[model samples]
Each structure stands twice: as C-alpha cells, then as structure tokens.
Target: MSNDRSKPWFAPKRYGYGAGLPITWQGWALTVGYVLIFIGVINFSEQDKPGSNFMSVVGMSVFVVATIAYILICAAKTKGGWRWRWGGKP
Candidate 1:
C-alpha cells in the first residue's frame, strides 16, 4: 500500500464503509424538512379526528417525494449517480 494523500480529508473514498452527512445546503435542507414533516405527521395522527386515513396518505406521499428528491440530489453530487461510489468532488 502507498501513502496516497492526494485526496483531501473531506473528499469521499472510492470504497469504504460509508460516506458521512450531506455536504451541500440543499441536502441539509431536505433532511431537516423531512424530519419536520415526519414529526408533524406523527403528531397529527395521534389526534382524535375524522379523515385521519386521508391525512396519513397525504403525509406519506410528501415523505416519499422528499425522500426521492433527497436521493436524486445525492446522486447528482456523486460521480456514479445512485451507485455506491465516492462523492464530494468539485
């Protein structure tokens, strides 16, 4: 093995256990938005009200859409795009 320090400490590894958190503002926003929506849904569901099923469906849809958007954003940042590869490059 060679002491290859060409890559910066923040640069992602081609193969490793896993990459850390999102490096972009959009990524962080999406993550925080998802969490807030999730919490809101849980609180709303716990209330005694009619049409809870409909609310649940809507919440689920929002969650799914957010998740897909987050995934796509991450993919766009990576070279392999949705595959297991290194990211955080210029």
Candidate 2:
C-alpha cells in the first residue's frame, strides 16, 4: 500500500485515516444488486403486459433471488474473518 495518490488503479493504497484501503463489502453488494436490478428492469420492460408471460415473471423472480443470494454471499464472506486479497490468496 502506498500513499502516492498518483498511482494507477491497480495499485493498492492504505485508504483510511492512517492510510490503506478500508475493507469494502459494499462493492460486492452494489455489483450484485445493480446487475440484478438491471436484469429485472429489462425483463419487466420486455414483458410489456402483466399476467401474460409466466416465463418473464419467473425470470424476474430469479433475478431478485440472485441479487439477494449475492448479497448474502458477500456478507458471509466479508464478515467471516477471511482476508480480502486482490489478485491472490490472502
């Protein structure tokens, strides 16, 4: 971790008060949530009329479940005492 703000995105930085990036669970949550939300929006929009296409409804439900599953997975992984590594095992 370096304090050089000019470093590239690939470089890790000590991001907090004392330097060093703080642990980021929000990132995973946001990624999963955004993806699912986008998929749901697309499916919902494509379906056009409601109560007509069962597959669309199912797909929408799956999207919601996947989003929730991602959140849970991220939460468990992040809070279970495992170290966060960038490119290799921690």
Candidate 3:
C-alpha cells in the first residue's frame, strides 16, 4: 500500500541534501556585471595605443557602475540577493 500525506501549511518545504540558496534575478545581474567588468578591464589593459583602449575603460567603468547600482537595487528589492546571503540575513 502507498501512503501520501499532505504537509502542514507551516511546515518548511523539504529540500534535497546539500540544496543551496535559490538563484534570484539579481544574482544573474551581478554575474553578468562582473563578467563584463573583468573582460573589459583585461581588454583595456591589453591595448597598446594611447587612446585605442579608451572605449574598453569606459566599458569597464559602466560595468562597475551597473554592478553597484544593481546591488543596491537588489538590496532594496529582494531577500535572496547576494548581499542577503553574504550578511543581510542570519
């Protein structure tokens, strides 16, 4: 015989072993931002001309700004953003 039981409303959902924090939209944003910033910085450093790499520098700056902005926004908007996992929650 098979038995099925409905969980109580207040009971926490059972996650599989080693289940980690769920990913949120802000996590995706931060990841993309960091990747862009890293690639931009590396590309900018590799350019040899006096002004040839200016765009890359600008790109990197934009990415840094975007990352900071998104982080702040996520802090205000989400409970599962990176900061929450880092220090925002117990």
Candidate 4:
C-alpha cells in the first residue's frame, strides 16, 4: 500500500504499532479538533461555575465519547491497518 496514497489520511509509524503524523489535511483537522475539545473540556469542566474544579461528570462523559470516536476514526483512516512494527526491518 506504499504506492497507494489515494485515501490515506494518516501514515503508519515506522518503528511503532500505530499512526504517525498526519499526512493529509483531514487527519490534521481531526487531530487538532480532538486536542481542542480535550482542552476545552479541561478548561470548562466546572458545571456550576468557571475555574472551580475538574470533576464535572458531563465533561468527563463528553471526553470519553469523543476519545472513542477519535480512536475509531484514526484506526480506520491510518494506513497499514495499524500494523505492529518492531523496527525498520522491512
């Protein structure tokens, strides 16, 4: 699939068993959106008031759901099917 770059949004890691930096705008946008949502959740975690605490149940729930969605999308978009790469032996 090295030469088939038609629909790949993320590239597989060279030495690890996951995705590397995004190779497309869609992947970058997804990553950035995920990070921004996480930060937003932390910054606005207080349900009653701002700057109170980080134990908001709603925030945690949203974070968990978003994280799961992000993981699923990443796994689907990443090239090589998230293969296990022991090293650059190939």
lDDT of 2 by residue, 1-90 (tens): 865333221213223111122244444445656686777668665866766776676777777777677545444433223334444422
Off by over 4 Å in 1: 1-19, 48-52, 85-90
- Pairing residues by index, what is the TM-score of model 1? 0.54
The lDDT for every candidate, in the order shown, is 0.55, 0.49, 0.48, 0.82
Q: State TM-scores per candidate.
A: 0.54, 0.37, 0.39, 0.79
lDDT of 3 by residue, 1-90 (tens): 532222111211133221132245445655566677678777766674675867666766776786687545444433322221232222
- Which structure is stronger by lDDT: 3 or 4? 4
Worst 10 residues of 1 by lDDT: 4-13
Winner of 1 and 4 under lDDT = 4
Tell me the deviation in Å of residue 13 in model 4. Answer: 0.9
Cα lDDT for residue 38, model 4?
A: 96
Candidate 3, position 12, lDDT: 16
lDDT of 2 at 19: 16
Candidate 4, residues 1-66, lDDT tens digits: the string is 465545878988888687888989999999999999999888767444666544677788889999
Could you list the CA RMSD of all candidates, in the order they appear?
8.8, 10.8, 11.1, 4.3
Index of the highest-TM-score prediction: 4
Residue pairs whose backbone atoms clash in candidate 3: none
